[model samples]
Target: MTEEPVGTLAGIARHAFPKAPMEVLDHVDVSVEAGLAGDFRGAVKPGGRGRRQVTLIERGDWEAAMAELGHAIPWQERRANLLIDGLDLPQVAGTLIGIGAQVVLEITVECDPCSRMETIATGLKAALTPDWRGGACSRVRRGGRIALGDDVVILDPLQGQLL
Candidate 1:
């Protein structure tokens, strides 16, 4: 079979509170048990405790969503843990993606926008609704430190292969 294209991890961010602003970071430690180190979600919810152990979104998709809303907004406003480039994040549930050398994540569901998005900007929630623009909720599978510029691989579970 033909090889699948690889993407890149362009950015990372985390927050200390549920509604706190996101703080962008250069790197983060991910684990099957801790999700992202120092993240509030990790501390409060713990890894393997919830489907949203990690959240991922595509930079392109974020931009598109902003354009649809007629403005440009910081990606951190979306509150995703990782920002990816050059990959169309799968909206389908159960899609597995590998970040960097380690850190395998299984996409559990579409991260639908919450009222907080509407609070970020009027019409933001509606803008993020179409095309899975709100990003995806994921659970950590294999853990490791993920950094900016790390390679992203799409793993095909059906074939037990990495693309």
Candidate 2:
């Protein structure tokens, strides 16, 4: 019944292909079928059925991890699609996040820290291990063209609260 203005979309990025350099976007056309326009993952799953269509990371959490590591790594290295700020993201799956005015994403799973994270720093993976600091994976439920700083709301907080 209560919707929370959880955060704001701070950044957006996409990669053309596996291991490709991430391209920072000022605005992106989100699609239920393609996730972010020109994103490689979208091309792999054209039907819009992939649960990991989009990935999100909390800016606060990312900062915390970087602080612990005593380094200033950019959020892009985490390889998430959207960077959010304000409140912590829900650790559980099934929560719905509404972005801007039209884009909606259903959380599907934890964006677990991968081995590549260790390549960035000695303890980077562990720094992002506790909580969902590594971010989350989701499936797009609604589509829209969104830009940085768009309002983000927690539309289904009841499904999962911050862990």
Candidate 3:
């Protein structure tokens, strides 16, 4: 029998420039050389394919943070490239996140909230902290088209699933 997906890609977003408002998309292109299409970070970065290529946040965690702050801000304010639901992202470095059947990402580090977060709301940066509420930073290992509702999976690197 086929295994059930752990979660679905709940949201997709991109930005035209740094510190610019995030533009939510129904679908996007992922690249090994340039992270997410239309995202300035991917094209502006010096080199192709490294940590911070993509940023993802858990839908539940974002809502919890918002609730704690008593603000009904949109998730796009998080400035994350993707939003996922149903799975808690692993904190361990080297964990793999698979999108759909082709795109893969290697978790590199915690995506810490910056001072900009505080500008959005008082204590937003703090609310996004404590147990990785800021989401995850990852490098694109494999690239392809990714769309909302695509299957998301956490893969075991040791099982020869690195591809």
Best by lDDT: 3
lDDT of 2 at 35: 88
Ranking by TM-score: 3, 1, 2
lDDT of each: 0.85, 0.85, 0.88
Off by over 4 Å in 3: 1-5, 44-49, 160-163
TM-score of each: 0.91, 0.89, 0.92
Please give, for residues 1-163, the per-residue lDDT of candidate 1 as tens digits.
7868889999899987788879999999998776888777753252335688788888998998888888888898899999999988878888899887878899989888999888889988998888888899888888898999999988988885775
Q: Is candidate 1 or candidate 2 better by TM-score?
A: 1
Evaluated at residue 160, the lDDT of candidate 3 is 36
Q: In model 2, how large is the Cα lDDT of residue 89?
A: 73
Worst 10 residues of 1 by lDDT: 41-50
TM-score, candidate 3, is 0.92
Estimate the lDDT of model 1. Answer: 0.85
- For residues 1-163, what per-residue lDDT tens digits would candidate 3 score against the true structure? 6664488899999898898889999999898788898897765266444788899999999999999999999898999999999878889889999998789888989999999999999999999988999999898888999999998888878883522
